[model samples]
Target: MWSTEDVARDAARRQGRGLSTAQVAEKVAEAARREQETRRQLDAPTETEIGPFATDPEHLAQLWAAKHTEWRRIAALLKTSGEQAYDPDRDAQGVTWAQERHARRQGALDRHAAWMRERQDARDELRTQIWLPADTSRRLRAIAARAGLQPEQVITQLADHVRMDEDGAVVVAPFTPHRVEGS
Candidate 1:
């Protein structure tokens, strides 16, 4: 694989070609514009079909169960690794690789925690904005209780169905419909 230094050298060589300074600057600007445009396109939301918003308590429950199972699996793996047994005296002064690995793991955990907190906050906010009937809310809460999730999870999942597409057109998610007959 080409190293960063190699890449820089290649770029310098390309710049040192017969092209004038103004030409090089123009080429760089054009490349930057193309990169920005590509990123914008990638970030843009695609068109989606809108349908009724229906929240399946069973599905939510299954999802929660799966997440719990995955978490347990991860915990088991960590336990087997013996790394979970912390040792304060584990010196990293001579173990640069281990120190780097530990730093990466810590960074990943920190990022995961931050993402989880942000997701929880967003779910809470979404729940407050949901305008489901009292009976529906009650049913949802009941389902959530059975599925090991908070009522807010049901509300947030349903809320996700009510969103606009890139063109500002209302696009409802198929799974979470606006109304369920007996919900």
Candidate 2:
């Protein structure tokens, strides 16, 4: 992954210029300032102002279905492997092989849920009549994680830079672009 510095240096190198670490730090500081401003603009004074924190019915049903499917799959796996997976010695440590398998399966399910969340966010945007990819939301989440901030806290930090396409997009300008290989 290219850090902000890597990207700046890459751009400068392409333009036949030598970029310094101080320049990168300055740019990062500027970004931090911009993000702070955006966060202020995007702030919702109250939870009610934001509306609908829970998943919508359709997506909720999908999540339940997925959860059920995963539960059955993991049970079946356990049924088959529990014999080999469980060890009396590990049970003393409060970590049975069955528990290990369950953890692994649960981790996979969690990953799937994470991806599903991205899709669900995009769908929700569309339902509200916007066309932003969930990837933009993921970028928001990433920014929040990196900055030790809440998603809503920094959401509007770059709003001024957004350019909406025709048909009304959800959000503009992901912090990071998702590029497909071999366009």
Candidate 3:
């Protein structure tokens, strides 16, 4: 089999030149090293460039807002040039790389915003504070655990089973309290 060095040497011989196999090999190795360095530089993020903006979201937002006009101009240019939306597989570099990465991050941000709103809505209920004996608190927690619910949920369900009389003092109910061993 003709190895790469052998082929390179044969080509050099056919060209009637004084080039040696070691020289060809060295040039090829240098080219490979340069290409590797170029790729590394392209892929590595500059911490000094992104660190401050990444640490402060409000600052990042202000910067983005400030760039609105520039963004609009870029959008118009792209539109006029008939450039399509980013496709990760086809456009792995250049402007489209930023577009694809920002789109994915924005999607995640939107999902987190929705989840925060949901949690806020769920917590929009009457807030109350009451002191119970340590033993009572322990029993309440135990009951909640047995029913696979929060302590508040257990109280809410029990309250659901009760009705106040006209006097607002006498209450009739079907629930019977059960004793739980204290830990």
TM-score of each: 0.22, 0.20, 0.27
Q: What tens digits encode model 2's per-residue C-alpha lDDT throughout 7-79?
A: 3333323322232334434444544554454445445333434446743444333433433333333334434
Cα lDDT listed for each candidate? 0.50, 0.46, 0.51
- Give the alpha carbon lDDT tens digit for every residue of 1-183 in model 3: 333333333332333233233443444454455445544554663565655435443433333333332233333444454544312233223235345545766898999999999999889866688799999999999988876677877777677677888889857586643333441
| Native-referenced Cα lDDT, model 2 | 0.46
Worst 10 residues of 1 by lDDT: 85-94
Best by TM-score: 3
How well does candidate 3 match the true structure in TM-score terms? 0.27
Judged by whole-model lDDT over C-alpha atoms, candidate 1 comes out at 0.50
Q: Largest lDDT belongs to which candidate?
A: 3
* Residue 55 lDDT (model 3): 48
Q: How far in Å is the alpha carbon of 157 misplaced in model 2? A: 36
Backbone clashes in model 3, listed as residue pairs: none
